[model samples]
Target: MNGNRSVPSRAERLRASATLHVFYGGIDLMVGSRFVPHLRSLERSQWYSREALLDLQNRKLRALIRHAVDRVPYYERAFHGIGLSAEDIHSVPDLANVPILTRESVQNHFHDLTSDDWRRRHPVVNATSGSTGVPLKYLFDRDCVAMGWACLFRSWEWDGYRMGDRRALIRGTDFASKGTPLHERIRRHVERNLVLSSHAMGPTQALQYARAISEFRPTYVRGHPSALAAVGKAMLSNALALGGVRAVYTTGEQLTARQRMLIEQAFRCPVRDQYGLNDGGALILQCPASDAGLYHIIPERAIVEILRPDGTPASPGEAGEIVSTDLHNYAMPFIRYRTGDLAVMEDQQCSCGREFPTIRRIEGRIISAVKRRDGTRVTGLVLSDAFEQLVLTRQDCVHQYCIVQNADLSIRVLVVAGRGYDDTVTNDIKQTIWSHVGKGIDVGVERVPEIPASRNGKRRYVVSHAA
Candidate 1:
């Protein structure tokens, strides 16, 4: 560490504050948003009691249900079909009476799901990354977008990050594509963000990113775990130092234990993992005061439910599918929306005194399910666990791997070889996969120089064509 590091002057701090205020004020005026207000509310709401939070959710749920019944064709028909009414769903528990909305239903009934008053709400269309092979489009009102930003900013505060803090964003190339709008470029510049592409993160690219980030001196490093791990590996291999980073935040993909270790070691900082879905309106962030694996759900953004296969609620420590309801997005409310992602429930409150509900861990998406020969499906989480075990047991043998399930129920294991990787390691990997997925299913191990990123620049550990 530099003993003579300088601190920002009072004038510099004031200037930064002014710039942040002006930028966000301009944005609010342009979009008629309430981002600042919402952020302030979230800061206070995090400390609310459980009963108070439940009241807030119930109030929001009532409003959302009334709006959906009155305005949305799909929800209106669904409610009426079962002889249900808005009055029936008076609280969070009452949501059980609402039909579960699937991704297929949203895609098939896109128009019907939209609110009749969408134009008045200034609705915007957004889509998921389509990592599962199909992207689902959804609507977001300006307020819903503001709330999303608020939720994100609130969670970031748990890591001691404030607005206008210097941060480096390693994201997909599409995030800052050549065709990006002029305003977005200006926003990135004004926000003091060093944006780097996660696509094609080879040794050269990783080194370049490392050098740029070191020079930039960002306090926060945010990216997908795989991309950050690749950069971290390069940094360690080449003895590159990135000083002044306080915390590394990972999203867009699950953060494996190995990836977290590599990132923390290379950056010399703690790693915080966050999970959110563009379509599901769910925002889950790791609690700074708790263990790394546990996450806190933002109650103001959405209502989250972890349910078993039979639509019953999963108990604490039990794994289940994630179903979410967007409390703010009245433009196109996704009531009881099945997110296709899995997570474990946590019943205990954090020692930090925050009442935000907790999730023990986020399992991978359901779309990454591999079909067995007998028509059974193996989840991505199982495969990920198997790979994690392999990395731990083999030491430096398996650097990176991806599982691709073909249409014929056959599996292809793509491996980026490491120090001790060879025929024996390959066979071991095959057996490991077979142990989870039944035997007699053809599993081929292919050694490759690199596993390419998807179109969205995310390195999916498991891809199932059968899904």
Candidate 2:
């Protein structure tokens, strides 16, 4: 496959995707997305120099601004309001006049959110029921999706995945129903991925999941980071060992340094971190290989900027709202979209020799932060990870969880239990939290029938409206 294959048509891609999802994994080339290998090669080219990377970045940024100026209504208003045209957006600094679009704006005005011609055109609408408070609905052109996944594939390859290596996905197991549909299971059987339910994992169940890993003996493990940590926890207890897997790639949650250390210890392999959202516009990643002090963001895919609370450009190494412009999302270009997440930008080249721009720190979703009894706010990413390993701890249970912190300082979890795990696991979680938060905090339990999905049909580990 070419590095820049034209994105497949939406109708054609959607039908095939639907058909594949009914089964465990898709082996059909018509429905197959060659994102992994594409990403691998792209990442391998990190050797590009600063001059080389910047030249490509400027070209792509200019093209992206042009796409927005001509097509997107939001950008049209923004450009006119700022008294600038696409040609005037010659340097990265010129991007400052364009105001940032927040997540609320996107969800509230979804219909009017896109470029003027977007409806007449078709976009690959992608959704995220993130671990944070709200679900995001956004559109991606074929090129953007390809680039995003390509970056991921590169991360995987760098961590030690060969082109034909056997792979396993520990995320999306519950949503796809674990290969039950006959066609879906058959597809997965051919593709070599076993979908295990994260909802069923617990401390004891972690042992069982470990046994399954020993049996599967996959070459590479890919999916949610928190879930991978659960598998590591399971492997820790049971003395279970994997035969062939050499690397683990964790995404979907913030990979804490603590969890990363444990995952590396458990798997005895290099653990790589990738940070991205469903909609186009990011490539904040980290690896055991380098500490370049910034995200090695793919230059040609998106242009990222950090903006302060007052909407001014954030200086290097200063935290601010993440704003992005995807060069290739022409179908519905997102110009100056505020990602809600916060990070510091760095223009320096990575020590690994990749000229990709790096972001120093990514503070995920501060808006969804939950305050603790100590008055210290619990960041969404931090709290989500603290609970993630537990959720995917065992695979023999049915679990739904919520972080219950009331005005009374009483802390407990609202959970729907599986057949064997009820009070025991709940108590364990309570003890774990109390150890961290301190004594005298009332820990209680609310056994709900099920964890309620937010408006966008995805679960949120922490959902509070307060900022």
Compute each candidate's TM-score over C-alphas. Answer: 0.92, 0.71
Span of 10 residues, lowest total lDDT, candidate 1: 1-10
TM-score of 1: 0.92
- Candidate 1 deviant stretches above 4 angstroms: 1-20, 175-177, 370-378, 392-396, 438-441, 465-467
For every model in order, what is the number of clashing pairs? 0, 19
Report RMSD (Å) for each prediction in the order shown. 3.2, 8.5
lDDT per model, in order?
Answer: 0.84, 0.64
Error of 1 at 400 (Å): 3.1
> How does candidate 2 fare on TM-score?
0.71
Q: Across residues 1-467, which tens digit of lDDT does each residue of candidate 2 receive?
A: 21122454677466544543443123223444444445444654566676876767777778778878787777777679878788998867777766667777777767655776664444688777654537778787654665676666566645554343467666644654443787666656655676666655455656776777778777777766556776787787678876556677777655665567768888877676667765547667764356543456666567777788788878886767777777667776676777777776775656665666677766666554555666766555555566656645766443556665655656657777767576677777777666656666776767777564443323445444443
- lDDT (tens digit, per residue) of candidate 1 on 114-211: 99999999988987757656778889887888889878877777776655778999988664356667887887888788888887777788888887
